[model samples]
Target: MSRLFRDVEGGPLCPQGSVVCIGAFDGLHLGHRALVRHAVARAQALGVPAVAVSFEPLPREFFGKAAPPPRLTLPRAKVEGLLALGVDHVGLLRFNARLAAISAEQFVREVLIARLQACEVWVGPEFRFGKGRAGDIATLQALGVELGYTADEIAPVLLDSERVSSTRIRAALSAGDFANAARLLGRPYAIGGHVIHGQHLGRTLGFPTANLRFGGKVPALSGIYATRVHGVGARAWPSVSSFGTRPTVDGVEPLLEAHLFDFDGDLYGRRIEVEFVAKLRDEEKFPDLPTLVAQMHRDATEARRLLMNEQQRATA
Candidate 1:
């Protein structure tokens, strides 16, 4: 699949006729996968390219003026996951006020109809778009009839009789129910960012953590978690990570400090991906540095044991 940045000009460039689906696709959860798969299937049947359109910064975050909710997948991760899904192209639209104001009618006519020449448009059952979220499935269908195209709404994919959504996944993660979140997401929950410097308290305590600065939206789950760190080598190393303001140090601004087992490389400025395997505890304030250090040691040992169990289970 091809991933487009904002640089590609000249409007939508799809093959002669294409099937397209558009959404924020924040997490690319099971629900999104179902919709995307449907669009791809339709494209295959029509012998056309399947194009997935997604907005960067999400429309809400751009206009809301407040920090948007923590996203499950950042742009890079989203693009990687989309490519793995085997779609023909992913349109990463840069959302600006000008593009935002385009009426739903005009969007369909200009982007979908004239630009992409889409033969079929697939959207989620509850999909809404255009100025002020004014368009719905019926509007799309009506427009499709006028434009010689077909509009189809794919029902949400359900898990345990409930629809899987990015919101639900976020809630589950915040509650530290990673198993359930992973089930909905179809993969382990991960956060991506560049390694930044920390207070070096962990180093003084003999932990030596690599602090990460969030690049996309915020992060889910503010607690201690068992994680797997990537970018150290071919395999992701098991780690124990804490996400919160270090109360013992009177720290501010939530930070993720991960102590990689047996790792001693300079990771500053390196972009790394950390996958959440399990949650160990909620963030808490320790009475003193000694107490915090003791708790960290316990966390490390437990994390190592859990990682071994996971590896053994996989082999079995």
Candidate 2:
């Protein structure tokens, strides 16, 4: 069977039994890492697979369609990150109206017991689930008692006495505080996707770029930034990046466009990660192409300086 599954109904994925961790897990921040790690450890000791269960279109995203919350990471990134944390399988369950309407008891019996055959289920603090968000750790524990399994919640991971959470990370990113975001995430904030063709206007402006789409999801950052592009060469490539709808070009969908400095290459179809270093400015429209090009020049210069300082600090 594939290591990833997307449905609530399926043949037994881990028929023999499995250890499980559940969460929204956007960004796979430090708190999330702790939960997955603990589950992986338990799975190892018990000689079973460690599975991570999370929802795509997350519950909040589905219910808040009119004003959807910003997504810290997209579906692919979330699954890849979960698997990287030693999970044997990652379940990005589709969360639509049908799934949302199921009661907590049905969720446990259908997903946890019937599908996963979970031997142990783990969740982070204050985790809730099922229709109307009725399920909690106590819910899981109660269901486990009747279903011949064990359920437990891990303590919240903290920094400076405050919980490390995706919300905190998003706030840090919004504030252009990459350092604080990284501290909470245990790494810098980045968005990764395969390069796609853009309008080619940047080419005419002398700032050719590699563009990436946000999978029709709201991105946490929406502005020009100094960034480092990874998965392009032996080392991270310094660059300037923009993550927003291109107001100057009449764009309506969020896009990530990175201009690698002092380099030349074709990146179409190449998967790369854009690590945000510092925010340059909020996205804005220009009066004309000439004005936009002029501002682009200034943005590039500032980005280069910021990335240079980062390199210096790293070496120091």
lDDT of 2 by residue, 1-316 (tens): 3399999988998988999999999999999999999999999999999999999889999999999999999999998898888999999999999999999999999999999999999999999899999999999998899999999999999999999999999899999999999999999889999999999989889999999999999988789999999999999999998889999889999999999998888999999999999999999999899999999999999999988988899899
Candidate 2 collision pairs: none
lDDT of 1 by residue, 1-316 (tens): 4646452246657748889998889889999998888888888998998888888878887787576677677787787777677678787878888778889998888778766789999998689999899998899999988888999888878899988898899899988888899899898888877889888878888999889756645776688988999887899989999987777789777788999999988999988888888888888988888888899999999989888898899999
RMSD of 2: 0.9
Where model 1 places Cα greater than 4 Å from the true spot, the runs are 1-9, 193-201, 245-253, 268-271, 312-316
Whole-model lDDT per candidate: 0.84, 0.93
RMSD of each: 2.6, 0.9
Candidate 1 clashes between residue pairs 3 or more apart in a chain or in different chains = none
Model 2 has an lDDT value of: 0.93
* Model 2 TM: 0.98
What value does the lDDT take at residue 194 in candidate 1? 85
